[model samples]
Target chain A: MALWRVPLDAEQIDVTLGIVHIIKERCKGCGYCIEFCPKEVLEFSKEFNQKGYHPPRVKKPDDCVNCHYCEIICPEFAIYSIEAEQEQANP
Target chain B: MTIAQEAIREATSHPLDDLLRTERIPHIWCPGCGIGTAFSSCLIAMKESGIDLEKTVMVSGIGCSGRGAGYVKLDSYHTTHGRAIPFATGMKLANTDLNVVVFSGDGDLFAIGGNHFIHAARRNVDITVVCVNNFNYGMTGGQAAATTPHLAKTTTTPLGNPESPFNLPLLAYAAGASYVARWTTLHARDLTTAIQEALANPGFSFVEVLAPCPINYGRRNKEKPLDTLRLFQDKSIIKNNAHPTELDVDWEKGVVLGTFVNNPRPCSTDMYDKTCRLEEKPEKKTAA
Candidate 1:
């Protein structure tokens, strides 16, 4: 349950730090992750994966507010958010 | 920090991964299909139900949606076409302790499996049936199914379906389902809650999930996946206790969606045990 909610406010408050993990192999090029993204941070890549599906890429990584709608809507489970920080920031 | 960021920062693990058979991923469903959304909602429901995962079993009939059983990391059976209900019934009656769930597509459940459906609901079998209604035979190249709307063009109905379709919710309600509801993939939260309620229910429970079959049903019907979802958003009216008969699905008239019925009744097992007496077996005392 906790994982389901991506906490949009948390991402909005901090603008400098955001990362995303895109497992290109797992992607089926549904474009759902790009289409349903509320933050408009994703776009279909010009390059195709091994499976010939155009996996999504983070076009505006800074604009990502961690809404997780992309993750939720992605049927392939290929794209996900990854929050990163410098050492000694939150550790 | 955002939860996603925090997770990456902390290097924590996800809780839901164990629920899925990751090795079998890159699922066969086409891009923009709604079956994945519906399946994910059902997974959320099962996780939230707090039931014993080990004792739970998933049974699926042959169809694109039937692949749900194979994808879930649980005790599952991918049975022959249109027999998921009977297989699940046998499992439930034999153990009486297992939680059996039947997940399949409209073609498998209502067309080839329609007879089993009525009998199961009539007897009030204790099982949760999730029917993903894509309005056609999605896996087999989108043929007109029992639930396909009139005037829709399918592979088999290229001239447009002259016959009317079955009203799933009305049928289930009339057949004596204890909990019956209809929701689209767009209504994930509501659908999840409805599925949880259905799983908790004691008697025959039915949930009809209206999904988009973009490649087959949509391409021919002149609708994109997102367009179908938007239609659901714009036209869907939530009438929680609406009469089943009045809830016919006609996009022109707006679609009625909600938990149409939620009445608990004694399940078949209870009635059978009460009516028939069984001789008590002696306890084994060998090598004591």
Candidate 2:
């Protein structure tokens, strides 16, 4: 991603990376996380869970900024995100 | 496996698992119902408030939202219908140190329990009341409730609701509540912050949470759950400190959402101790 107006200290800044986690069985497929995620990182999965609902899948995993919007917005508490480790960020 | 897939595989528990009754993995609320969102926000606020969890108690009345008490891992009371406030008031009076929070639905809080709400606020009880207004009695087959919007369709009001809904914030302010606010389930961040403020306020506090009742209220109103959330996102005007009278639940005209009141007053316990306690008089005499 290229910044339209790069800051003087751009090299010093490290954009946080996050990994999305989905608990399939707990999801009721409300689509709240998908609809409200700022990064547009999630999409409905093709496979259904035990309850016969399609849980969300991380489509653009690297795009996530660890906002936790999906976690707070999920009524079912099915999705969350945690910050990526240093090795994972480079890898 | 990709990083996201690896994370999902390694996920053992949610951060909120410690605060919730995890055994009840899936709650009873239906798909697209907003109660769970509001409930989760309340829990998040409780966690963020930095209060002593051991001294806090959650009280709830009978309704769909009333089930909140059962899900929280705390000293919670699932009180009788419309009696959550009174029960909470009793607990507050008995142990002034406890942080009492009443979580109930529009039907439970305003319909049968309406009087209790006003009286508690009027007396300035030191408690936080979270009322989830879904515009109808969702659990009871979507019956018309005290907070149901005017002319809306419900199970009982099939043709259209004839009466107008109560402006909850205005009612709370009028009843002498010290802190009052309104927010929708879609505005989870603001709702959580407002609940935190309500919990910290020294006197009676009331926060009204507007949630979608898709299965019952929406089916008849021609609104899908997503549509209702979109409406909340687009139509809500967040004017902090807006007058209470302007905070009505009108979708077409737009809903006013914010903290309307935050002035502290002497709470009921403090006033009672000041005026009625006999032991305090001896201390005053000795000082003189």
Candidate 3:
């Protein structure tokens, strides 16, 4: 069991954050990520990525529990979850 | 399954019947899938456990094995794939009194959920996990799962699986699963006992059920449900891990069958709560 800990705190006002992105190229379409997420945040995209596998696109970013079920179940090392970037409105 | 059958013994309190969610019947599984047999076995264990119904929380991830949590009528949650243990951990920590359990499949537990499996075992969380191994993943057209034997024929591996399969129980034992045992559905009587023991044990308890997927793996191997079970009875040579020489047998064609290991450790929560104490609740003042 590989445990990856994101040793950071949540920052407010994150816009278009790159929290988690699918690698599409290596995905085997196992659907483990869609099946295991505590939050129904991921869905199989209608469009197939360059890899020819239907990768999961984040449908609801706020719902993620970050429990890491997706990162663990991905046999192909396709999905990587990271902290969302902080977005600030210009004063 | 087994636990639910225990309900029959009373015939009066109807207490066991109360423990089952009647609405969830007519479960979706292929005929002759050992999951059903294993399910009944689980039911009997819960019935005999004498534990309070409300306190037992069955948390499960996806796949056929995930259905094990739903069969029981308790504070149950059919959680997402490979997430049952963490959900179970949360449930246990939130209450600390409930008997948290994870009923899941090999693909859910060892493949995608493998990391959580080890951490849960290492933490020695106060929970019981029963992983049903049917070799291949039967739910998805019999694809080769992590539990499938190397070179076994599966849908994805039409030629045969080139990857090595897991020694599920050994992995658990290594990661500090305090109470660990492996039993084939053929050893239903033995399995019932292991479940009983796991329910009672303090720390993380794991039991691997070597069950059959007749429609999937069995079809290729040309075996019926009982035939697969009979193999466990006739050929399995594993007894005590240290005393293999006592039994004479060919190693390849046979799988080990029994309640192999049973060790108890201090509950993980007990240790965690000892140092990191949460602040006490403040008293609310009554309106003057």
Candidate 4:
């Protein structure tokens, strides 16, 4: 919904919801996912993983569109997204 | 387990786990190195190419990128430095049905294995070569490599590299590659697509991937990993089917990326079977 002008049929189209998952232990804290994410949904967390590098956290979880850009861009296979359940999408 | 813990466990299990060596979780790549992205793209392409995984092989040469063979859950070969292509060629010839993919670094391919690369391409070998060009000898303390750009700083070339870099796409095209393409690590989606296309090509296919050597090449050049990624985003232009001659790595003038050549030629195996095997079969039949 980060559009300049809402589409006329926006309400009719069911937007696919996504749940961003971050595996803190595997992350190297490269920040590629944070930088390239189209939705700007992730941000660096203050807490560090075992490697002492800060991993990303979902800032606006609802904004994720299941594009999987973060998953593909993540140098570490530490993050991924699965489509949210129907109940979570409605909620 | 609590629901939250169960969810966390499920989330941590990646889709690529089946394709990767699970025991090798947490690869040795640096925080900002681009090889991981390139390697993952290759894995995705291999999965999506719909090829027979049982008969597929991954080969690597000695380098940071060469560690790829160790991480994959496939029949892989970790060959000697600069010999990945030759080994892959042998595999393809011996087992024509096997899908051979040579994944190695620019230094390993173009520096020590340059002759093998040209010869393989010239013969139109039925194999796919993915070269990750990080612009320096990363595993060897950031030394200047054959793909190091002019005036780039490296441990060996502190004052800046004096020699020009090779235009890999042009080299592959001139050597008779049936398909050639170039993509930076930032273009992960396109890179995967190109790899898939290269996988499907019948003859020699070369894909040159531009990756960031933040620890090695970038440290001397004063470009951080993020800065290099930003440059890749702002400076690269997509020109599909562009002449191979125009495909050079010029960061200042913008980098050209896309599939440059894709015309099929009779591959080496087919030619050999047609000329050599055809004659031998007739002689064997007459003797019988």
- Listed per model in order, the count of residue pairs whose N, CA or C atoms clash below 3 Å is 1, 0, 14, 0
Over B1-288, each residue of candidate 3 has an lDDT whose tens digit, in order, gives 244322321122112335556465445665456675566667668878888866788888999889777767777899888888888887787677788878889999898899999999999998999988898887787999887787788989999889878887778877888887777765665777888899999999998888878888988867776566556656765464522222222236666655545677777877776655556733322333
lDDT of all predictions: 0.83, 0.89, 0.69, 0.89
For B162-249, candidate 4 gives per-residue lDDT tens digits of 9999999999999999999999998899999999999999999999999998999888898899999988888999999999989889
Against the native complex, each candidate's DockQ, computed on alpha carbons, is 0.23, 0.52, 0.01, 0.56
Judge candidate 3 against the unseen true structure and give its global Cα lDDT, from 0 to 1: 0.69
Query: Candidate 2, residues B74-95: lDDT per residue as tens digits?
Result: 9999999999999999989878
- Residue A63's C-alpha lDDT in candidate 2? 95
- What DockQ does model 4 achieve? 0.56
Top of the candidates by DockQ: 4
CA lDDT of B193 in candidate 3? Answer: 80
Runs in model 4 lying further than 4 Å from the true structure: A1-14, A86-91, B1-10, B280-288
TM-score of model 4's chain A, to 2 decimals?
A: 0.79
lDDT of 1 by residue, B1-288 (tens): 356643442222223467888877878999889888888878878999998989898999999999999999999999999999998998888777788999999999998999999889999999999999999999889899998999999999999999899999999999989999999887777898999999999999999999989999999999998888878877899899899997887999999999998999999988977766465633322331
Candidate 1 lDDT score relative to the true structure? 0.83
lDDT of 1 by residue, A1-91 (tens): 1232466686556454446667777777877667667677789889887888888877776776555456556666666564445323654
